[model samples]
Target: MLLIDVVRVSEAVTRTSARLGKVGHLAELLARVAPAEAEIAISYLSGELPQRQVGVGWRTLQDLPQPKLVATATLTDVDALLTRIKAVSGPGSQAARKALVAELFSAVTSQEQSFLMRLLSGELRQGALDGVMIEAIAKASGAPSADVRRALTLRGWLPAVGAAALSGGVEALHAFKLEVGRAVAPMLAGSAPNVAAALEKAGVPAALEWKLDGVRVQAHRSGSEVHIFTRTLDDITPQVPELVEALLALPSTDLVLDGEVIALRPDGRPHTFQVTVSRATSKTDVPRLRAETPLSVFFFDALRVDGTDLLDLPYSERQEILTRTAPPELLTPRLTTDDVNKAEAFFTDVIKSGHEGVVVKSLTSPYAAGRRGAGWIKVKPRHTLDLVVLAVEWGHGRREGKLSNLHLGARDPESGDFVMLGKTFKGLTDELLAWQTERFLELADGPTDGWTVTVRPEQVVEVAFDGVQRSPRYPGGMALRFARVLRYRPDKRPEDADTIETVRALML
Candidate 1:
């Protein structure tokens, strides 16, 4: 199909307020695509490249050659260009890449150019992403949405599952199964305010396990070869040789283990989350860095073993299998109990061990991949503080022209000034967003950046965050981790806001 056709679908999806309307638009486009062009169309419409990274940036795109004002750029043509772009690297490859980018950009119409730019920059403002796209694929193929989601989850790639569903319908989706070496998107949990609430939501006989503050890893071992994947399914086998060796030495020849890899002190307590992230994201000198900052993995669940797929098994069955195969020292500390007292005690134990929190799971729940259902719940203690809102940035897409993203700052008691920890654009309802826009606009300074409206640091907003991290970007040398606005504090003054010292204390 023509690239313009897909662009029109994208535009229609972006323009609609209704989710079903967006899905319908995408479904219509998916139905007409050819089998071979299926992946490219889905990837493009989803604002991603099949080749993943194209190595082009905004600076390189700024001075691209003028468009030809033609709609002749096919999806296949774009894919080929991306392939060439990915191929260019090292030395004079920069100039070669620029030339290729300009050459490709010059071939498409101006509208197509705009679409390409948004897709390439990862700034496709459309609300439609993988979730919506999966629904659309299912709708187009006349398959159950649940089946499509399961297939996509098992395969960890939407385009391929989408193509199969298109070509072979529900049977193709049903044919998809858990493969030993393949990575699947792990099941995620919904959050509850406290342990009792989580247990209530997840029901009785809940399997509560330590929720470690670390990078989630899905390890696959078949014979001597082992592959380690992140929660997002990026293969990181080359980055952590020690992890590979550990998996390779496991008694089970074929296995898939779901767990968290945490950096720990020699005494066994976990290092800070920042240290864990640094160790996991390290790309240079795997063997050398592995010794400097070693990661200890604690397996919480098992999905496959010895060519047997265990995803369909209940949580208890999977846990039993994991305990049987996983090394005792590497197993995540867990408790299976219906008593709220026991669950609460386990939660307290996890906190005392320097972990994040506890995950309460249903005993009878199957591994529902890529879905955040009521089967699992994460219970975390909220740490809240009154912080001053320094500024509010304009929202995007549906939220356009509204004050949404908040610039939160903590009071520096020593200097009597607010220091920016970070910004949060989450946990706001439409009503709250509109109210903030109106209220913050009244307190706006005379001059504004058009995108950001600066205001006096008098409005105190109650913010709840997971924790604080050492950051070089902020003047306070710290930033709030996963910060969200709970509500505006009308009674509190900026002087009563939490201090930088308080934020730093949380880090400790």
Candidate 2:
């Protein structure tokens, strides 16, 4: 199929707000895709590239060659060109890559060129996320949506799963299973105000584990081969030799453990989140970095052990397996209780130890990967909301040339529109400023007014604030007090943002 066909489907998906409409458009495209091109087509339709990275940047995309008047590039043609671009490296590779990108752009129509720019820049926000794509895949392959979702969770790559669904049907999707080395998406947690509320949501006899402010690691050990993946499933085995060594020391020859790795001080208190993340993600001077800021792994749950998959097991059972396979010092501190007072005390102790908060997990609940279910509830001592970014103002002073001040909005459930709440520029690091500036420009919907740039309300950010107060400046009739950004929520969508009603209830 021509690349223009895929671009047309993407445009159709974006023009419609109904979920079924998006699914219909995607399903129709998927059904018409050739078996060999299924993976590339699915990946592109889902706003991803099968090649992952192609060394393209926003600056390179800024100056493109004139697009062709006709559309003739095939799906395979684009994929092959991207492969060639990704292979360019070493000296003079940047110029060579740019030339190749220009060549590819010059061969496609204007619409195809626009699609290529968004696809390469990683800013394609057509709302056809993995959830919607699963339904589309199921509809096209005549398989159950649950099976498609399960296959994606176990496989951890939608392109591969979509290809299997299109080629081999249900049998191929069912072939996916949790493997020792392959990383599955980690289970997520919902949030509550306090320990009592978390416990109430998790039910009695829940396990409250310390919510450490650290990097999430999913370690798999199969004999001497050990692989440690970050939350996004990037293999960091070389960067985290300590974690690999720890996993190799475990008794089980085959195991998949989900946990956190944090840098702790000599006093046993955790370091600041920035310190831990910086140390964990750094790629320089491993031995020196390890000596200066070593990471301590804390296992919270076991998904696979001794050739057995424990994803369907209850939280209590998984905890039991983890306790037997890992040492007490390596396990995250936990307390199982039916009393809210005990849970509150545990939460206090964890907070006092400089941990972030506590995660209250239901004892009888099974692990649900890639989901934020009610089975696990997290409680922190502050007020935080996941709000959408409506617009951003260019920074001044040291932050000049970057997108700094963020205009925050809360989703209005009734109108399905985002209502502006307030603006904040606090809590952004230099790295975050540069990243958001590039991303917001890609999502830009309106022309810049020299001071502010209006963007699509697709980016969700976790904002920490003191409280909410009445304000007539915002259409929501409220504003956040002392609002500061906590972090960007890439895993969440704008639809997952806190509703306007939820923010207003904070006034009570």
Most accurate candidate by lDDT: 2
Superposition TM-score, candidate 1 onto the true structure = 0.76
Q: Can you write out model 2's per-residue Cα lDDT over 82-182, one digit (the tens) per residue? A: 99999999999989999999989999999999999889977787878777888899999999998898888899999999999999999999899998889
Query: What tens digits encode model 1's per-residue C-alpha lDDT throughout 411-452?
Result: 764334579999998889898899998999877864655888
lDDT of 2 at 391: 97
State model 1's lDDT: 0.84
RMSD of each: 11.6, 3.9
Angstrom error at residue 118, model 2: 2.3
Give the lowest summed-lDDT range of ten residues in model 2: 489-498
What candidate 2 gets wrong by more than 4 Å, as runs, is 58-70, 89-103, 386-390, 394-404, 409-421, 426-449, 454-461, 466-482, 486-508
lDDT of residue 457 for candidate 2: 84
Give the Å error, residue 326, model 1.
1.5
Q: What is the alpha-carbon lDDT of model 2 when measured against the actual structure? A: 0.89
| Cα error, candidate 1, residue 460 (Å) | 22
